[model samples]
Target: MKLAELAKELHITTDSFIKFIQDFDLELSECISTDFEVKEDFARFARENISFLKNYQKDLEQPKTVEDIAGNISQPADKVAEVIRKEKPAIYENGVYRSSVSSFGVDQKLGGDYNFVYNYFGKRMPLAKRDFIGYRDLFFYISKALDPFANENTTLTDWGIHRPAGIILYGPPGSGKIFWAHKIAQIIGYQFKEIKKYYLGTSFVDGNETSFNDFLLETMKQEKVVLFMDDFDNVMMERTATSSVNSCDEETKEIILHHIDRFEEEELLMVASANTLTGIDREILAPGRFDVVIPVFPPNVQERAEIILYYMTKDLSDEALLKQILEKNNADHLPFWNEISARMKVFSNTMLIDFTQSLKKRIRTQYLKDNSLDIDIKKHLQPALREASAKLTDEYFEQMSRFIKDISVNNYDDFATRIENLKQELQHYRIVEKPRQAIGFTHNSDSK
Candidate 1:
């Protein structure tokens, strides 16, 4: 059998098979060609390794207490607890250990309502208003939409209470549109259902539109669901337009629109997100279809500061040390944190996260190179900050700024107004009156 065939039989990646070979001190060429035959001895070795890895993975998957893990691994419970505390601290709340809600092998039964909910959102972490750092008003608006049904007496139409059929979250890419959608679902006590592009594609290709629609409607009828469709523009693109690479066919577009229309009678909450509203079908955005359209802009100065602080120090347990690091970075002369945040006005949450991760990697690399037990925080971080700052040049900012402006102009006056108001709110929004020495430090050092 060829190396690729061997990898396929083992149900592992080709790169992993290469690594397995290297682990056994075998001198094999890096270019493991697709036609390279696997030796009998190596095939036996690979099978053994694969069996061991699968068993180890199964152990991890099974829910176990710290004591159970310690006993199984033949280590002290304290050591296991410490490892959990360092890695997955959220699971160690209230001095009791809990396992993460896993959804492995559950995607195959997408037609089942219960399995669909459990598979997609069973493991979602609980979120509060504060968790949605910058967009509190938007969060509250969504909450209000679901509040009527949440209360028994107020849901009566006689009392003039009605649930919104749909909401559109539009903005530049990397903005927290999808994140807020899931958070809204969690807050409103709804099972979140994400409708992927490929799901639609597969249904159409297999001529299963009716069956798929039935499955979706059945799921909605069974429970109060937050149905989310990301990249809505692609699915609802103008039927007449052929400019987009993945433009929706008229039949597919009509099917999606028909589903939106059904939301009028059903008590379902539909949330759709898009980077732009340029080419979407106008019917999908009609009043009854998507009741409210909101714009999610990039974070402002204070929000950016908070985002930076959150990502940078999320893993650290030493509150005093975290405070010192923040203070050092936000000092008057350097103002490293403030300056970086201000400079990143065009950055979305994802971009800011990636930049912070790069900075961390640089700091870690330098610390490792110096062979030091203690990190010289200032010595390594300042240069990384400067490098990150230099990378987001004027040209990049200008390009991103133009993209935001262009997308905000969707040919509808009311929609444009909402986008403008959002930008203004973010511009004037200040989480703190003045930049604090330490923005996110807490008294409870254990809290992440």
Candidate 2:
């Protein structure tokens, strides 16, 4: 019989039965199949292992510790604690462990200010303020703007002592804009609320203007909120631009601009990201609407090396195997890593991450198929890396280069000053040797 049928017969959960079998280091071929044949030998084996199964079931029935729960689900303890706070609110408040069902809401609606705060910021992992990879100057500027004590030395009524209303981060897609947004919110200790296009649509109300305005008002009222809007240009494109189709109608665009004029509350910080600055409304890019507009470029050579090493070390859990791979391709230390990064100069951070994840999957599949851990990573991964590199064609680089040049020429003074300032800031910071942890939710964080 299948493991599900066996679990039914034994009056235990399939997970519990699987864990029992795994604890003994026994691999059952039919465990994952729902329609496997149950021979006499399999029945006899289960009968022989009945006592062990009973013990496991009893262990499952007992109260679980925080570590036990985390290990069982392969999640961090902080995530478990947050889920407990959500699922068993009274138990968490009482500081008591009780037998209760834990319902993880991965797709639950985020309605009001309170739900938005608890759902996003409350459950976020605690990361160091300096954990952001690059873009030191941009991060520093934004942090100062969000800081409550930024203008402590200046007079309160001074004209120069005004809080920034919002920030616009424009860059190539998959260039870590959203990641930086989340990290900014975490550093400022504010609840994050991301306003999507659907949230601004007419489905919620008879008119899209009402829906958009309501979202803005709800977000603005929160005492500590970082409102993020991804793809700013898509939502607030120039009404007169003729190149591409606009998602928002003229009335909707006018409503957005009206709200932008009124979005000067100190309690709320607005941050938006777009792939390019072209075709964006001039008014939205005006000084008061979005006080800061920064352009994020692809990673430089040093930053690329750091990113590659981070992903390579983070995904390859086997320390010995990782060391071997790093030493491969040449006698010099870390030559393999340096070589890979050099070859992947055109890769964005997101592309690097995807490539590493793909390589990890291939390695796992090979290991399982060969029934051996000994495999040549370089031999297998180099070809895959080349395939990934092929996606970054000459046309892609030309498009990106043209966009950068256009923005620079359009705002020459501001762009030149910002680029020079970034260069000076980067001189003070070196790439620290550390593995990058996966951001946001992971497989373990999802519901089973």
Candidate 3:
């Protein structure tokens, strides 16, 4: 199961929740043990005595007993009982925990031509169970992407050779499409190799089609390769000066088509991505060629929340922490999580503010409390007031005029101080929000 699913069930941080269950064996412990039940008195004692237990651990410099450390949980036994079904230790494999790794964009082309990876931003949706309206179709799409022949992967009898199904993801830049593909692949345990859709499509051996054809045939013979082609748009559009859109160019297309057919016939998996479908020659991705056409777009709220939880795995995990991380970062949860997981230190809270409408308004309230937004300044900043009052949106952007009204500046030194404060505010916003831009989402306030 995905981490977010478990996190939601337990209402704890992903790291904490996962560690307690999968890593620490707490979840399994309860399943196996029938005799043990936490007593109310015992729970209270544990809660009240946590400070002493911590001090004892500090003094002893080693574990004294299971009860000695109180499961590293400082609250009452009831609290622990509430969070975990029960506490029993189970041994976990060493090296089970690993730091999250980020994939820098990869470059691969179908032939020797297009250099950049085709970009896509797909919605990260939860699995569906019918009764649809508000439910986005991305989950079904992901299931298909994960198992290209998802329906067919269950074949009972062998015909010739059964190559496993793989997928192709193509879409617009900043669409966050490829990331979703990677996540689905991760869930299913497929080794991923991102190919930048670069193809010279330049003729070989006096422009004999055999050169590229032979090369592609050699590649097709390799096993378990997804053959992810990015930017399929550039090569297929017949943009090459070398291959004019003539009959000979059509022949070049044939060589390419033949190899793709070979991969399909042989049951080898291939996923090719393109930003603009029109750029791609229709013959390549036509019905029998690629199995499915999955369109990826920027995340809606639920998908963004799932991604935020995934990224914040290294930081805090619960609703509270998620809210904080979103607010601290000041960007929507998706980009913040994507960026922070890169440098996040494990343990305790990693900062993010909640990007939800309610949470953002709460944050604004906190800001108002922290600094005085007095009546005089409010009177002077009528335009700012009008702008902020313009709608019932959860997002509220206080104008710079309000910022200026509050500051009493006298000369250059004071101005510099104000500038420094402004710099800090802007800096926090950048630290919080820039990653959204990094992963290709627009950095507008609406994104939050």
Candidate 4:
């Protein structure tokens, strides 16, 4: 059964259930598949412990403090505070330092025993074998958004819920916004069509000029199509009093807004890709327009490992030299890639693939020279790692910081864990600039 369905049966939000798993230190991999399938054993545990899970979720709903967490987990308040100091920032309110800090993160840091939660594990369910790696939370969220479309007997309409007319996928460059856009189309059985640059402007079509309006009218006539527009942030940016706005982009926004109301009725979904939602005009994001916002996060640590391994041995046979080297170094497994992946915090999917490509080439060269099975693979990986690490520039982090802040404000409840994890990962590169002291002024009291 799917984890979302299990959550629905338990009368709890999937976000809360995910939090429960994290708080108990339950192995997420063992309990849920990459496709968000709930292992039968974990499902049984949840059904039997429904009350316990509900009560835990109740505790999670309220803003918590160091004392609250310490009491709940039966640990010292100071220890909990220490853990929170490193993990998350505390919000002060009502005469207390409080925040929605993860009790699971705090407990793990305090060495709290959570083995009881794992007793339900009977046999490990293999990850729903997919070309994609992690981001199960994201997939589940998207599934929920498209539920009305998937279920023929869905009463979502009674609750005033309908399929979204538009979905805005926002993320940093190369985080795979376009990939998820295609995935969304695939899920709904819609034909994916890109709104090319020429389609957005007056272009010669069959020796006649056709504008964006003509393109929209013709697209709406189709049965089911997802009209994708990339670089949406650049086109739909907020127009300030003194800011220069593009006439073509303004026209594009106007055109989308004008025809957006009829999108759902016509079985057409318009999906736009943007680097960040911070700049999009508020009018364009209004309800019944393009309000369904989904974030495409860069792969987390575990995901990075999986992606690296996937690319490293992509098409190599068992007898292949690279395969032999990987097996010899035990680099074929996920754990072997963890340390390096940990260092590649906040790297995009494109960057990770580049890393694997670089590593593979270096390994091939070394093999050609040494002509040995054990060709000191680690020695070649260093340069490849350096090459990939170069892309982790200051500008990229700036973009991610904006993305994190935007998600925290708009979709915090749904993505709290990811927001927190990314914040922690970003801390490594966030250097505080100390003020420079004058060179000539040193106190000579000791010398005197």
TM-scores, one per candidate: 0.53, 0.55, 0.36, 0.78
Sort the predicted structures by lDDT, highest score first. Answer: 4, 2, 1, 3
lDDT of 4: 0.80
Candidate 4, residue 27: the lDDT equals 55
- Superpose all Cα atoms of candidate 2 onto the true structure and report the RMSD in Å to 1 decimal: 22.9
lDDT of each: 0.56, 0.57, 0.37, 0.80
Candidate 4 per-residue lDDT, tens place, 1-448, comes to 8776888888987778876665554555667754467877888888988887776667667677678778888999888776665444434223243224566556766886656666668653333335366776687688777776765355365676777889999988889998898888877788999999878768897899999999999999999999999999999998999777899889988998888989989999999999889879999898878889999999989889888988887777669878889999998788889988888989999999999999989988888887888877678767998998888988999999999988888787677667888999999888899988757767787347
Candidate with best lDDT: 4
The residue-level lDDT of candidate 2 at 418 comes to: 40
The residue ranges of model 1 lying beyond 4 angstroms of the native Cα positions read: 1-130, 144-161, 203-211, 241-249, 319-336, 373-448
Best by TM-score: 4
Worst 10 residues of 4 by lDDT: 90-99
Ten-residue stretch with the least lDDT total in model 3: 101-110
Candidate 2 residue-wise lDDT, 1-448, digit = tens:
5444666786666555544433332223322211223434445555666674565566555566556666655667677777655444435544434333221121121111223213322222211212544444344444445544233335246545555567777777777888878866776566788987777645545643456767777777777787898878777677664555455545556766677655655467788897777777787778867757766666755556656556655534445544454445341234455666665654677778777667766766876788655667777668668666665656656545554565566544433434333344333333577986678777865546
The candidate, 1 or 2, that scores higher on TM-score is 2
Which of 3 and 4 is ahead in lDDT?
A: 4
Error of 2 at 1 (Å): 63
lDDT for 64 in candidate 3 is: 30
Residue-wise C-alpha lDDT for candidate 1, range 307-351, written one tens digit per residue: 776677666655544445445555212245676676564566877
